[model samples]
Target: MRRRFKLATLTAALCLLLVSLSGCGQSLAQKDILQLDRHSNEITWGVKADTKLFGLMDVRDNQIKGFDVDMAKHITKHILGTKGQAKFIQVTSQSRIPLLKNGNIDAIIATMTITPERAKIVDFSNSYFDAGQSLLVPNGSDIKNVRDLNKPGMTVLGVVGANSVQNIKKYAPKARVLELQDYAQALTSLKAGQGQALTTDNGILYGMAVQNPGFKVVGGTFTKEPYGVAVNKGQRPFVREINKAIKEMQADGEYNALIKKWFGNVPGFNYKELER
Candidate 1:
């Protein structure tokens, strides 16, 4: 009888071990996504603090504000309950993904494009916003559209991680491409006459035009750039939560309100096109 009792005790411990392992089978990102409400009820989102309209730091209060800011807060509340807290971390195009991978940030909503190349490493929520590539040039320049940028001497300024330079080459093979550190630098270079034109999403270009009087977005859009919220690869739970929150926002009219709040007043942009 004592031998049988010992065997039963061993079996019980093995069963307990299996149960514990099963509960912890999830990765950190997955576990965090699942216990969003219980585990501190706080989420840190990576966003652009320099890119205007999408996400930028408001100097007055030293807080990041813009379309991405509002969306992150909205989604955080939706997923983690109304009392959920969202901490914002500024990340650039070159650094956002790495930060997400290293567990520094929970998700990326910094106007990032949902490209297949990016998908191999990170999981992206459904396209939350639709955008397109366009050009910003000094007012009255000879370059009127994408077709006019094919000259051999025409230099196009782009940001480091932006795919605009590649698309620009496809659209204007003869044009020279100059990559800068960020959009602000790219715009500064364009204003300094380093490049004939700056290329990025039209929404970003519009923000630049608002800040600089003599530059305008021209050539319409050459490529669709659908913005998405991204999380680490294998974080399907996190991605699904984001997608669900986005749909909820759309159905509840919150998405339209946000679009109207930011893009509504943007000059040369048709905000109606962004309505849900």
Candidate 2:
């Protein structure tokens, strides 16, 4: 009787262990966002809170608003069948990758440039916005463009962890470089005379120019910085869904409408080709 009881206990314990393992395996396999509406109901997204035009916080409305924000909202609506269901997590360029990797964000809709180097770390959706590197300088400054900054002792301010500093070196090898913490800090340093110019994407520079009339983006783009949405590597289904959403927006005129809403009136920027 004692042996039979022991055998029964062991059998029950083995069954429980198998059930637990099976549950874990199912959870792992069910992680991808195959059904947008259902999954986004439980997921949160990471978006830029600082980037102007692309992403910015609307202090008066107490909501984050911009082109990227609108785009993300639209994507959520299309995928989840509702817009307000998913939550938004504010992210910076330096924090986007880490947050996505740690599973804090379901996806990134910031103005992240797609590059081969970054591709090794995170998966990128199709290019949503085309942009290029450019220079921003104080109004009436003699430095009209990159060519003028090729001389030694010329200082350039760039954000840390961004490829902008490296591109600055390649294009203006003689200029002294100062890396700031973020775009706001870079602008502050530039205004404080820490650097002769600021280097970043033209879209962002344009936004800055609109805000601070004292600064202007000079010269055309020096390097293409195609912006793309990023997800964790191997999340092919999520990437595909985002790409499909972008393509649909482009085809349905929503993409061009967003471009016009943010960039149509910006001086010197031609928004013709961006129209659907």
Candidate 3:
């Protein structure tokens, strides 16, 4: 009887703990947001510092800089004003959701594709950038597109936690896939000849091509990847604020200017297509 009572008590305590944790994750109110932004004058954003053009660390200043970084800055200013602070935390594809769910990040502005699966877990703002999946291969390679990858022994590379890893198999059932932690690692493996082709959104592939010559993006596109800013699920107030900021940027031509600043001179990429 005593042992049974002890076990029951432990179970009750566990339940209470879980309930408290669940409530702690409840949606944030507008006032709470204002307090955080005003009290701290800073917002925490998750970003990818290893992915070039989207978010990469600049050696010169040892600071993260890219399209996502710029957008995060502009959004922070919109939310917190010129003196508002924006703190960026490096997050990989696999780590982003967990970090956001744990409250380590207030928002995610990484080159993350908005998908139904992710939407179920976190609220996402409207599509801020449009992209499509494609293949990046070394120059003079015979593999022209994804269809060509559907052959015995052909290997495709993708970033872990990215939908592309699973989506690639839909088009090339016979090909094998290898997932790395980030875009930089995927490209390094590609150059090392570990895989026949690297698969990701064309915009990212183009960025990779710029840094590493002799590699070209082929196979126009296989999937539509709409990039969105993500926040913890049920944060409707925060989501609305982000959407408003994005729209404001578009109205002022800041959106187009940012697109040009990052992707303007890349060969084989048409910046006009991204103009607001």
Candidate 4:
């Protein structure tokens, strides 16, 4: 009887172990973004809701609009056909990676730059947009470029969690850096005279400039900031599909058209330079 009880206990523990292993396998399979999207026929994307020319909330329509949003929709069509829905969830720089890691978002297309540090945590798609770090200053200000901000007592505004803030440290070692929550807040602070210059990607600066004519993007790009779509570390399939879709769009001229549609008329910007 003692031997039989021991045998029964051992058998039950083994069964529990197998069940736990099976659960783990199911969890991993569920996290495979490509398979998940296929099964649901939808791609949930994390995108910026504050940056103009990239992604911005359209208050009138209660929908987000901009280049990133459009690109995501087209990519969804390419990947999942006409029926596959592209769902956009607003994400800030601070939240995007965490949200992705936690399975809250399938991918990130929020003007995110691919850096070695970030690559360690998540996989990135091929460069979809070529951008560069630059500065925005009030017109007629003596600060013509990034170099001007290197002087002591000069204050530069940057968005928190954006690589631009880190990049600025290399260029303006002596300048005081103030990090804001978003582009809107940075621009507001800049306008309020809280900082002498606002720094970020030239494309984003240009978007701000277009709306606020008093300010302008200066100091042509200081660092290359090639934007890429980000997926969880193990999601190679999703990354490949995104890369493939980008190439198709470029090949068919859809990419250039989107570029023109959003950027063609911006003052002081050469839209053709961005066209594929």
Candidate 5:
């Protein structure tokens, strides 16, 4: 009787263990494809809602529209197998990575610069858009470029939590950097005479210049800032799909069409320079 009782207990324990292992395996499988096609046939893509030309919300149409938006949508169609139902989530430069890591966003197509530090935390697609750092100053201002910013007592304004602030130290070691909370605040500070110049990507600076004609990008691109689509680390399948979509767009003229749609007419920057 004692032996039979022990045997029954062991059999029940083994069954429970097997069930637990099976449940764990199913969870892992679900996690692997959580960001794929599981959500209403929609892909939630991260895009900048404030940065004009690249990714901005069109209030009139109630839709986000720009170069990045169009490109992301194109990639979604290729990856998700359709584009009509995908969604856009407004993401800032500081929030893009966290959103992707937390599963709040499927992918980030914001003007995110690919860096080794960022790559360690998130997987980046092949370089999709190539840009460079530039300086923006009031029209007729004396600051010509980054070289002019390397002077004691000169104040350079950059957006907080952006790579631009970090890169500024390399270019202007002697200048004082004042980082604003966001691009809007940075622009306000620039207008209020808080800094000698505002530094960011040339493409973004062009958007600012267009809105405020009094400001213009000077000393053209000093540092290369290659933009890439970001996904959570270890998502190899998603990364591969994004890269393939980008390559297809590049080969089929879709990439150039987006560039022209947003950037073709922007003043002070040569569109032809971005070909290929």
Candidate 6:
């Protein structure tokens, strides 16, 4: 009788453990993200709150406003309708991926570039904005282009977790690269003369130049930096919906309108080239 009781207790405990494991698995399973957003009527986005044109924090009401924010709003409407809410969460270059992976945000649209490495962990939608790696320097600095940075003793400023930093190493193998926390810090370091040139996407540099008349983007663009909307690893449905929305926006000239709205006034940047 005693043995039977012990066996029965053990079996029950084992059953409970299996049940708990199954529940946890279900919780972690790939969800239909599109349907989830529709049901909730909201899509939370991780965006940069410091990068000027792509995503910037407007001090007026402490709200983030930029091209990325507007794009996310339009995408939310396409996914969940006009009534759906688009919630923005501020993210830095280092925090965006971790936030997305931990489910803190539904998607990331913070001027993130799609790369073979990033695609392994997070799925990216079709390229929404075409950008390219370039250099931002003081108005009369001698650094004219990437080739000039190839010389020894040149210090290049870059934002941490940015692909631009990685690309710079290829173009300027002899120059030392200093990675800052974000665009704000990088630009500050440049102003303080800590680095010779700040490197990033041209669109972002153009925005910075617009704000700081003393700085300018030079060297044209050495490498393509196509921006994309990122979702979790298994969210193909959500990616497809975003791609569809982009196609619709482009076909109806909404995409071009947004391009003009943000980049039209940027000095020296050919915004028309971006219009689709």
Question: How many steric clashes between backbone atoms does each model show?
Answer: 0, 1, 0, 0, 0, 0
Per-residue lDDT of candidate 2, residues 1-276 (tens digit)? 999999999999999999999998677445775454364464477887777888888889878878888888777666666544657899887888888877778788888888999999988998888889999999989987798999988999998767888899999999889988789899999899888899999988898888899998999898999888888776897788788888888889888889899889988777775576
lDDT tens digits by residue: candidate 3, 1-276: 999999999999999999987776554322355456668999999999887889999999999999999999999898778998899999999999998877788999998899989999988999999999999999989988899999999999999999988889999999999999888889889999999999988988898899889999998988999999998765787788889999999999999999999999889898899888
Pairs with backbone N, CA or C atoms under 3 Å apart (clashes), candidate 5: none
The whole-model lDDT of each prediction reads 0.89, 0.83, 0.90, 0.92, 0.85, 0.92
RMSD of each: 7.8, 6.1, 2.4, 4.4, 6.1, 3.5
RMSD of 3: 2.4
Per-candidate TM vs. native?
0.88, 0.85, 0.91, 0.90, 0.87, 0.92
Better model by lDDT, 1 or 6?
A: 6
Model 1 C-alpha lDDT per residue in residues 1-276, reported as the tens digit of each score: 999999999999999999888666545545555465348788899999888898888899999999999999999999888999999999988899989887888889998999999999988999999999999999989888999989888899998888777899899999999999888889889989999999999998999898898989998898999999998877787778889999999999999999999999988899999989
User: lDDT by residue for model 6 over 102-166, one digit each (tens)?
Assistant: 78899999999999999999999999999999999999898889999998889999999999999
In candidate 6, the residue pairs with backbone N, CA or C atoms under 3 Å apart (3 or more residues apart, or in different chains) clash, namely none
Question: Which stretches of model 3 miss by more than 4 angstroms?
Answer: 1-35
lDDT of 1: 0.89
> How well does model 5 score by local distance difference test?
0.85
Could you give candidate 4's per-residue lDDT for residues 1-276 as a string of tens digits? 999999999999999999999998678645778988999999999999898899999999989999999999999999999898999999998899999987888999999999999999999999989998989999979998888999999999998899999989999999999999888898899999999999999899999998898998887888999999999887898899999999999999999999999999888888888888
For model 6, what is the alpha-carbon lDDT of residue 21?
A: 92
lDDT value, residue 82 of candidate 3:
90
